[model samples]
Target chain A: MKITFPHLGNVYFAAKALFDELGIEYVVPPLSNKEALEIGTLYSPEEICLPFKIMIGNYIKSIENGADTIIITGSCGPCRFGEYCELQMNILKKLNKNVDFIVMDVPSDIGIKEIFNRVGKISSNSSKSKKEKIKALVKALKIINMIDEIEADAHYIAGYEKNSGDSKRLLNKCKRDAINSKSADEMINILSEYKRKINFIEIDKERKPLKIAIIGEIYTIIEPFSNLYIEDKLMDYGVSSKRTLSPSWWVKNTALSPLKINSLDIKKASKRYLSLCIGGHARECVGEAVIAKNEGFDGAIQIFPMGCMPEIVSKAILPTVSKDLNIPIMSLIVDEMTGEAGYITRIEAFIDLLERRRKSVLFRS
Target chain B: MYYLGVDVGSVSTDIVLLDKSLNVVEELYLKTKGRPIQVIQESFKILKSKYDDKQITASGVTGSGRNIASFLIGADAVKNEITAHAVAALNIDKEVSTIIEIGGQDSKIIILRDGIVIDFAMNTVCAAGTGSFLDRQAERLEIPIEEFGDYALRAKSTVRIAGRCAVFAESDMIHKQQLGYKQEDIIKGLCEALVRNYLNNVAKGKEIIQKVFFQGGVAANKGMKAAFENALGFEVCVPAHYNMMGAIGAAILASEAVKKDEGTKFRGFNIAQSNIIASSFECDGCPNRCEVIKLEENGIIIGCFGDRCGKHSGKIAV
Candidate 1:
């Protein structure tokens, strides 16, 4: 059985590592691009959010490349994402692209035994011994954390690097080397080496760069293509950006959620504005904005897909946060029809506003 | 010597020549007619008729077509319309707190505190409250666009029109016309509806204080200015050169940019007679199918852009 999965940033790296170690045949669909979005848009419901359409495109592309098993995480939350699996399955069936779907829900939602049963369905196809399979899972976990750390450091240091583009160049090379590694251990080594190198890059401590926190929907924030590679754009502009969400963070949050100690800092930060979980990381988005302000970030940018219900709530509340915290915040909504020129203009104007606030005597009382 | 500024927008191409002291020396506003290149060259031809190219110190470009316009004219400074507009407004009056800009295809609200731009918002995913919609409504009513404001001013009573969407607004206008409303009153209603839409949508949640400046092509509509004043319950200041403020700002910026330079990057007025072409092709290198735009000058490929990969974005050596 050839397995496939949608792209969610570096999650594909972990999936590749696990599948390779398990001796499972898998087809990694091409990176999310225009063709995938076009196909997905043609088949998806008109009102569905951007991530769903992109996922549909990924599935179709994989199906064309001989993938029969599709695995995706499921949520039982109040968000429309909870119904995505059923809708996608029906759509694929209608298109006559037959494939098996393995939904990995949280242990509390699906029960531990049921979760393992679902997991065993995939592991059963592997020829590896039980111990080696466990080892592979552990390595995949390590790979995700390492990659996330490398990416975070690269983004932050880009603003301080004495030589412009050093961090970005190294970061790109690191991702390329990690992907091209023959084994998971080799990938880990390459990642560690690059992490060390990025830290040692020459930085002028006296130089102050605009620090922006990226807070928004998980799918849009984690997936670069969905948000039109905003983080990369920020890096190119020599702005330090931080995002609290990542695949590793999700893994840890899911594991600790049952213990009721997951993301306690974020919950406490978000308590004043949003006291309840409105679902789909709305609370997390609010919390991150507050956290960014408290951490002395210059501004925050909230990016989400058009028609995103949860983010719409966050967008409404963010103006208040911006007023109270005295931190500038900009909300960018991305859809398939999002024009690049308008998007760039908004970003440029926001940056100009921030810079003028710092340097211009016009703001002096 | 003069610093030149060009604003190539969707509907009009505006050029302004500023003296060394930043006074407006000459101004020209020409219809774009969907051909910015031709309009820009025509402006240069007009400039050449009056003064030598050597008399120009520097040049800057702004508006929606700033990139291509800058490339063609060899501008010393290129900036987005928001910064240019804010700069021009601040230059006119430092105490200006709010800028309501309604251009041909888009509208924006810029808020300033203590002469510094603090917050701003632009119309997103909709063109319901811009000059283009107003022009279309005037055309549908068989009224000259320049006389649209005069018609609104002559209205005996106000009529309510939907301002949520352009399509709905048109249908509502027709519905009102069918219900026997006077043409002038309907035009007045449209002006008010558009102002309401702009305030609610583009300027939503913005803290607009005193010394508000209204600019852009729509600012030419006296009815719009009056509607803004009536709605906000205060006078909305429209600058004398409101329509060409973007070009004025661009010229001011160019003068500042060339302060340390040996000379201006102005390609000279002779470029008006040069052959320049912009063409695009769907790149087949990847599935992205990016429409790569290539610019040529005198049969030589000058530059290529819009490709995600760097493969085709480089300048081809002559």
Candidate 2:
């Protein structure tokens, strides 16, 4: 049976997780590029959002190579993702390609458990009892979650200096090792050992001074699109940074939060065990900023979309907290118009602030 | 004397330290535990334990999170992963015509003109065919992620799986399994789906050139490698440090930045002592609800971020 992932970002994480559980093999779409865009734009109707084009393109890419079934998540939110299954299905049918589809909506539409039970229909009947199926799924979820966690750690590492390959080599090795891991316990061991092996060179204490924290919505935070690549912008200024949250962290934190809710955002940010704050991870994120300040970071950054509502609310509340906390904060509202050069100029000045502040503190101390 | 590069992506942060001669010195792969600060702090602690006395000359930061890192650590130079990755690839194998990258959150295809990124496209929206997707598949099968390729290799006939997206892929896998397809066949089909997704999404517009180099975490999958070869009708080369190329790229850029800059703002190898603060303010300055952030240390504003306008002004910490 073939397995696949749909959509972007955490979907990758989700796919990894699902596969690792079932002990199955799956393929990855080619790196999305101009060709995929062309195929998607050509095949998918223009009226659909850009994501659809990309999604349809993924299916054809997989189908051409001999995939007969596709798997997708189910959503119920107002966002277009909720209807993605229907849209994608119609688009595929338009192409007249006979393929089976499994849309597993995460948020739940009709019933969560019932939808999940559909798994019984796929594998051996008696061989797969409810307990066994759940066990497999749980295992898969764990692996996927672990991979996501690793990816997140790597993002922060990306902010550092070293040959690009150094971190990637280590990360890939870690991922390969984790994937081939003997068991969950073994995976944790592999990750811990891997982490122990990393090396982060510190600048001359006399010279090395400024530290910043970057927080924001997932898209702008990770994707180069909405934010116009804020990471490089700050790096140009010579400031080190701290970021909050990654898929890996998100998953692990959720799994572990029941025991320590007060420490993690899953508890600090909302009533739910998970981060249901929408974009408002900002509230807890700002709290993290306070924590960072207490830890001695120089400043903080909030990255998000121009019109993102959850983050906007966070923006509204962040300043008052900033004033009370006495921490400097920078908020970047990005869109297509936010160019590279503009971002660089602002970042330069921000670094200047950090440098000057560091000098003053040095003099005072 | 050496330079270092770190590509901090959403899924993971990669650290690659290279000598002035461009020899590999040290490498690290870390999971960002909701705290990039902790990741760096941990890295520094580990690094100090190993090579605190080494004469490190320069460093670079790249990837989506580069700006945050550059400021936090005083990165010498900041470069884009595409440029850094392409540059490093060319340095390793100049003849490479195409570069494929599949990280945790996104996928990219870079076409080169004499080693420069003349054309590129990325799939930031879909997760159908990324390393993470494969990991999920591996999880479902209860197989080690590394052995996904082995499973694919054993498949006599692959039951096609649609990897259009994660949601579809998962459900489809379940369906195929219900159809009573062998696990190996399902896996092989899944491998083909990844190849299909990659080609259709990111590689569609561009010509499949020879001398293609596949990097990023996904390159670890042998099934994917074979699928790529089968689909493209050519061999795809996986870089030795395929996953860390972005970090290496940033390091290359950092090496240049250190040479170009005079002073360093590194917070020392013991950045553990440095304080970091993040806050937000919605800019009533306009209808745009811009939340500007200010960074400071010892009661002094050090840097600013999260503003769309230049309204929030200060010396940037990096």
Best by DockQ: 1
- lDDT score for residue A120 of model 2: 42
lDDT of 1 at B288: 55
Whole-model lDDT values for every prediction: 0.88, 0.63
- Residue B5 lDDT (model 2): 75
RMSD of each: 2.9, 24.2
Candidate 1: clashing pairs of residues: none
DockQ values per model: 0.40, 0.01
lDDT tens readout by residue for model 2, A1-365: 66555434444544554555455555555433334546777887565544456567677877776767777655565445567688778878888988777776432354657565755444433354567657766755665555555554554454463443344456556756765565445665776677666544322344453677777665456543335545544443344555665555555554464465534532353332224544335555556656667777777777765455556666666655565665666666654343243354344434544544444411110
lDDT of 1 at A336: 92
lDDT against true structure, model 1: 0.88
Top TM-score prediction, candidate number: 1
lDDT of 1 by residue, A207-238 (tens): 78989999999999999888877887787678
Report residue A274 deviation for candidate 2 (angstroms): 50
